[model samples]
Target: MTSTIRPSSVFLVSGGAKGITRECVIRIAQRHQCKFILLGRSAIVESEPDWAKDCFEESGLKKHIMEHLLSQGEKPTPMCVQKVFKKISSSREINNTLSRIKQAGGRAEYVSVDVTDALAVKEKVAPAVKRLGSITGVIHGAGNLADKLIEKKTEQDFETVYAAKVKGLENTLSYVDLNYLEYLVLFSSTAGFYGNIGQTDYAIANEILNKSAHLVKQKYPDCHVVAINWGPWESGMVSPELKKAFQERNIGIIPMEVGAQMLVNELDAANHTTAQVVVASPATPPARELDSKLRTYRIHRQLKLEDNPFFMDHVIAGYPVLPATCAMSWIINTCENLYPGYRLFSCTNFKVLKGIIFNEDLADEYILDLQEDSKNNDFNEITFSAKIWHKNLAKKNQYNFSGEFKLLREISPAPTYDFAKTPDGNKINENREVLIPNWEDNNFYQNGVGMLFHGLSFQGVKRFLTFGKERFTAECCWQGIEAKQQGQFPVQWFNPYAVDLSTHPLGIWLQHFYQESALPAQLDKYEQFARIPCNKDFYVSGKIKSKTDINLIVDFVIHDLEGKVFVRLFGSKFVRWFY
Candidate 1:
């Protein structure tokens, strides 16, 4: 609770143009507590910001995405194709940025400056003070670290890198009104302290930042100047040599988003974030890889999935054609076992496929909708014409979600097959067929994968839901925020199918509460069942399953393959009588 206090009103971010800085800028702006003045070498436009957005994607990220697209021979998008990376401020990108801020009801001012220049530095820093009144925090993200040897490096390279960083720091500090600013963050490299073999110039520059932290604090007691030392991230700098080195060392990629979050967490409380070297965690290629290898090492050697075509090297290669039914079957089999029940599919035109499989018969119709959702921005209110109860009708329903596990419908089990008694006294049985009801809904988008105890809605299954006071819906649905009620606690990825509670306090009261429960779902496929009818005043249909006891036998059977000219029919018939 104490951590929620918002920071000061204005934040000045240097190097707000790219990489980890981009995430930093975004995170700060997202807080909506401060007006962001983004200063960078790239283009930025504050007032009418169509152009400033050009700086959002870093050059390295752009290159990765472009290469990925171009390899497929796709027509390049304007954001990726043009050398706009060099264009700091364009009329268009700047205008877009400004427009976006205004639309969001936020304030932003952009100043493009070469932090490398001292006079330009004073020029950029002074005006910000005059406009914002008192600049409370300064994130000294400006940095330049060229990979080179100390002996082979030219004097210009050293001077250019150091002057820009060290001088930019001095120049930024000089212009500040000592009373207002509270914290200053400087981006330093871990190489400054640890020292890499080839990056001597980079190492020296980082060392300077590390060494100067104390001097900065003494000079400005009213504010904090922190030098943040970071390690190399895999998807960054796009360094081929570094990439090769990492591969050889078997180092994993450090996600920029993780590093950005850590930076924000530190920024919220202090001026400098006060660290010599914090490791900039959320370290990538987590130990899970090693754990996974160790877990399968024995079994892997015993039963190798790497048969001829299934070999490990076949990973990067795609199959051109199938030999027979075994060809597609092998792929399905491999993929199924590799990531069971997690494959995505597409069954429509001009859109992507996603979501978990529900039922094969149902999936035939559902995939088209999944494609539609992939193309549509808003997840709420996407409807369809359905033949419900043998009646053809058009119905509108809302379940705010995105991404289709187009494969999900294939996995949909008939909930009515095993009619367990609801905590309340109501009979829900498999023999009764139900009608799909329609209703109105309002939802908020959510983000993240952790199980939410409160907001509960199934992204892949929406047929059983309705709109009302206790409706299952997610708000702020992005990242992992699903508008669903409680989930299996502590687990990252969880989904509760048509889950409703009757005994809990929030259950009866019907308020949104988030918590995690590893409660297992009861899955059964019913050919037809009674409709769980939703009361107009509430969300879901109030139906309960009645219990029954019967004598039965369960048996596991083996099958035989009937081979003809080319194909084989594999099946078996077994009897398990019940009363």
Candidate 2:
């Protein structure tokens, strides 16, 4: 449907004296000789105002006024400064805007009306409609921002912010005749669309406007109702500190002229029946930025027992479960895809929330959501709260695993560590008394760690060394089977198979100490100090830090023949299994 308004149409705009509303009025007036009734809370003054020429020109005036207020021994708080600015400059601003509209060949008038008050809005709007004829368009741009972290916001702050947008739109709707209205535009914000850090109240208020617009459109089909979710504009509303914050996040501020032009184009086209439309520039440096607040990346894989029949060999309690190491590998693979040059430096708070069980009848879909955290650029750290959920499961508990991962530049310096040594200042030799001699020659396929031949290709331990009651050391070799199986060499810092094999000593330590089989339940801190070679021998050493009835806390490291550490698992944990 064509949603066009004539030049002689009557338009009523709220918060119309300054900022975005003023810019819209100026743009519309330049194209159409419409009658505009500008509504604002500040009373109009008859004085010629020099500051009215430019919105930012009042900075010097505000500084002078603040100095005078201070010289009079008064505290110049934000409220005090605003009250003084409004008293001295509000009238000139209103008068100047009206003059500009008239010069653009549009008839204009200003009225001081509290739009949140239904009776006041009706009282003012009724007279304007009677004087200027039926209202053709209404722009509800009135909004107040009480930006505070949700925890710090009080009841009064929420009410104040809500009054201008939510309450003001309600009052305006009550007075305006929707049947005669050709356009009803609500200026919403991106805060409501995607949310911002300290804009809880503002987000709620604008979201209400967006939903209300949809409801209004159902009743007034002919009248175009739209809520434009706008980003921060380069205006007085955005402070320098706020601008810098947005810049750091790669969020671009909408230019004043560009925003004004968008408003005109939307109203002129009149083809928008969707009720909600977003008007904002794409995020700068889009590579690292996410389109949504919570980014979910997904992968679907059918667990076929026939295709990889060896997976059935790693069953626990008769149920086939994906290995924890493979899960970590999948997450690392995703991170590598999202951030090409960055590598996983450390993973902490890793927990097996629930075990994923496979079914032959249905294919399983896995979901990975990486929530962006407050970044610390000084450390070159990009932290994310990562989760892997089983999407095909009908059970209420869908999360298979959850953890926090940090990615750093591959060029970052490796961590330095002093491995435990002997009193003679030489590396500790494998104690022959406790060592398992000819471990590789034993029937590992029948009597070994739970991993079978196919699993062993990735998780086979070659030798055991320095075995003791609470501490042990062992050697594992990466066969590069992952490269052969997948037909491509993995460039990840830590080989998943090699890393998993290194943890086998922890299971041996658990069997020797607790006399039971155990599985890795949680990993607190896993750090990769350097990249491991594809097909090379690596040493793993671990020591028990503490032991509970069911859990053992251990620290382990994976290093090369030269004793250069490749990966370290600190504050690691294993849970003893009964079945």
By TM-score, the best candidate is: 2
lDDT of 2 by residue, 215-234 (tens): 98998888888999998899
Pairs clashing within candidate 2: 45-91
Candidate 1 error regions (>4 Å): 1-8, 44-85, 88-106, 218-222, 234-236, 250-252, 270-273, 280-579
> What TM-score does prediction 1 earn?
0.40
Q: Report the C-alpha lDDT of model 1 over 477-500, residue by residue, as the tens digit.
A: 111222221111111111112122
The whole-model lDDT of each prediction reads: 0.40, 0.73
The ten-residue window of minimal lDDT in model 2 covers: 421-430
lDDT over C-alpha atoms for residue 3 of model 1: 20
Question: 244 in model 1: Cα distance from truth in Å?
Answer: 3.5
TM-score per candidate, in order?
0.40, 0.52
TM-score for candidate 2: 0.52
